[model samples]
Target: MLSYVRWYWPEEDRWNYDELDTDRWSLRHVELRGDGEVLAAASLAEALAARDSGGGGAVVTYERRFGVVPEAPFPPPDGDIEPVLETLSAGEFEQLWRHARNQLERAGSS
Candidate 1:
């Protein structure tokens, strides 16, 4: 199981979630979704710091089981992945998404 921290950005009406293995605090996955599109990070703190650097002022809600975020439609990402910044170009985003998915699948089987 994994632990995660969820953040809500009221200004953009979006949410970003990050997961890390509780024992080692190793970042496993990240998701940033707004209006249904997901942009998915680094370490938990590093990820949040990166976001904060962007000036969004997101508020931390709570930490809980990675896959059990209330009201979120999709299950948490499998370990061994990180999301690209939302500002990435379409082509870059596609490449990053594919890489992340491949990593996730590999992690699951190991």
Candidate 2:
């Protein structure tokens, strides 16, 4: 299980990782603040590299661990989950999300 790890802090809207917009990996492990902290050698190396490159907030060596254990080899769910939604295209789901987001934003701004 080797993978790229990233951390996200919602309160601060900060991410302790490289620019995700430019990162090529579609599947990744994104650890949030609630996941808890951990200190790994790879995370330490990244912090060290950041400091060497003159980046701020790079001295911190701790990383957030997802603590997630997915099914071995990752299989689909055992039962039907909104079979109608499953039949829809990915773009339709995205559009639904966009609409919901817009509604929430408008409500918040009201």
In model 2, where do residues sit more than 4 Å from their true spots? Answer: 1-85
In model 1, the Cα lDDT at residue 29 comes to: 43
For residues 73-104, what per-residue lDDT tens digits would candidate 1 score against the true structure? 22335524333323334445345445544554
Tens-place lDDT digits, model 2, residues 49-93: 656875554443222222122222212246333122112234443
Shift in Å, residue 82, candidate 2: 8.9
Q: Candidate 1, TM-score vs. the true structure?
A: 0.29
Could you give the C-alpha RMSD of every candidate to the true structure, in order shown?
Answer: 15.1, 13.9
Where is the poorest 10-residue window by lDDT in model 2? 62-71
The candidate maximizing lDDT is 1
The local distance difference test score of each candidate is 0.42, 0.32
